[model samples]
Target: MAYDLEEQEQIDVIKTWWKQNGNTVLLGVAVFVAIVAGIQGWRYYQHQQTTQAAGLYEAFQGAVEKHDVKNVRGIAGQLMEQYPRSAYASRAAFIAARSNYEGGDGKSAKAQFQWVIEHAKSDEIKDAARLQMAGVLLDEKNHEEALKLLDSKHGAGFDGLYADLRGDVLLASGKSDEARAAYQQALEKMDPSGGYRGLVQLKLDGLGG
Candidate 1:
């Protein structure tokens, strides 16, 4: 009888403890489940976004190939608006910019290039956009503006190209000595085995360096 009473007393203690802590435990479990669900949902949404963005990019490419400027712009705009952070958006902008430039729409080309420069997540893309924009400015004989774009930050890999463009701008602005220095810098920064090395050397030779 005494042992039965002891067991009953232990059972009562357990019930009291559960009554005090059960609610907290349940709340923790609920929070954990919600967090897991939220993470899974976010991942699924991101995958869907990437798939949609890629589809749009492919459509944009087809439009570009067909010289369908209206469709290209429409698709590119959608990508930029909906998936600005996606890699496809930046690539779309690049393609649009090149097509516009080739089709004699310098204004549109510059706008697209500027968008890439401002919105692209990749440093390489931004540098490339700057270089292309500088080229457009040079074609327009806006030497100072071209130089300004070249003066911005660039990656190490782009140093040679940036210097080359700077040389071209200087040369066009009647600064032969400065242009020679810029060309020499280009040759110094370029990879020894790069095809651009030979081009830079040829330019230097033409400049009597």
Candidate 2:
């Protein structure tokens, strides 16, 4: 309506500034909105994947409970192929590996263990997979490979288990002295009162350590 002289000048300056920079401001706002929406979409997609993987994992558990090794393996394959990034995928693979190992399918078990070693998100999971793989190798009489694998760096809390397995591999390989040393290390690293400690002690005693 009516503007003082100074007010009119200020308004003019604002109009000039808008004409020069309005398009840039609009573009920046649009890009920001797009980025925010993209982030929300990505989050939603991740949530959906986690939910679906959880459902599949429940099914995998049911099969495991029923001792349906075939179904367990098939579902594990699907989880691994479709939701490789999900925690369920690695857990499923771990279960499948154990199932195969127990069922005398060392080939499939070893393959799954290798997959976990390569793809597991958790250090503990990778360590467990490595240990199971060593067991498979020991069964196959691949003592040297098993020893080499056990020698690899393990995560915290796995030192004792690795040492125990190392002892087993050494004993199997006819290295009684080394086996005794490994078993002694296991006894030292393991929990003082853990149930497994007794077994390790027995092994050591068997070797007269």
Candidate 3:
């Protein structure tokens, strides 16, 4: 009777273990399957975006080579709208901005530069956009706006150019003292090995600072 009771107890314990662990095993399988599906889905999305961005990049290059301002602008606009997050889109915006600027469409150039500044995925592109936008503003005699943009923190990489442009705008506005200060700042920031050092020195001489 004791042996029979012991066998019955073993059976009960096995049943309890299965009951507790079976559902957990099933849940684990489900979670693993979900993770695999998510990885595959992400890979597919990356492939699709890469393919689209490549095609757009090729078209953008072709348009640029053709030098057809209208075509370049249209294609760049479409590419940027369709693939805003793509690197190609940021490049296209920069190209389109230059095309528009050369075509005497300052308004469109400003818009394109603004888009690049706000949406570019890279800091280099953002800096380029900011500089170009400030230039356009200065051309349009929006001195205050241009100054604001030039005065923005562009870090060390862009300090020299930013200060130089700020000086130009200040000169245009007849703020000679401010212009001299900005020019001196630009000189201090410039690399001694850079080609612009001579030009900056010329500017300094003109300012008599």
Best by lDDT: 2
Tens-place lDDT per residue, model 2, 1-209, is 99999999999999999999999999999999999999999999999999999999999999999999889999999999999988999999999999998998999999999999998898899999999999999999999999989999988699999999999999999999999999999999999989999999999999898
Task: Give candidate 1's TM-score.
Answer: 0.88
The superposed Cα distance between candidate 1 and the true structure at residue 14, in angstroms, equals: 2.8
What are the RMSD figures for all models against the true structure? 2.5, 1.4, 3.1
1-209 in candidate 1: lDDT tens per residue? 35588899998998999999989999999999999999999999999999999999999989988989889888988888899999999989888888889989999999999999989999999999999999999999999999999999899999999999999999999999999999999999999999978988998899999
Show model 3 residue runs off by greater than 4 Å: 1-15
Candidate 2 wrongly placed segments (more than 4 Å): 2-4
The Cα local distance difference test for each model comes to: 0.93, 0.96, 0.89
List pairs with backbone clashes in candidate 1. Answer: none
Instruction: Give residue 141's lDDT in candidate 1 (0 to 100).
Output: 99
Clashing pairs in 3: none
TM-score of 2: 0.94
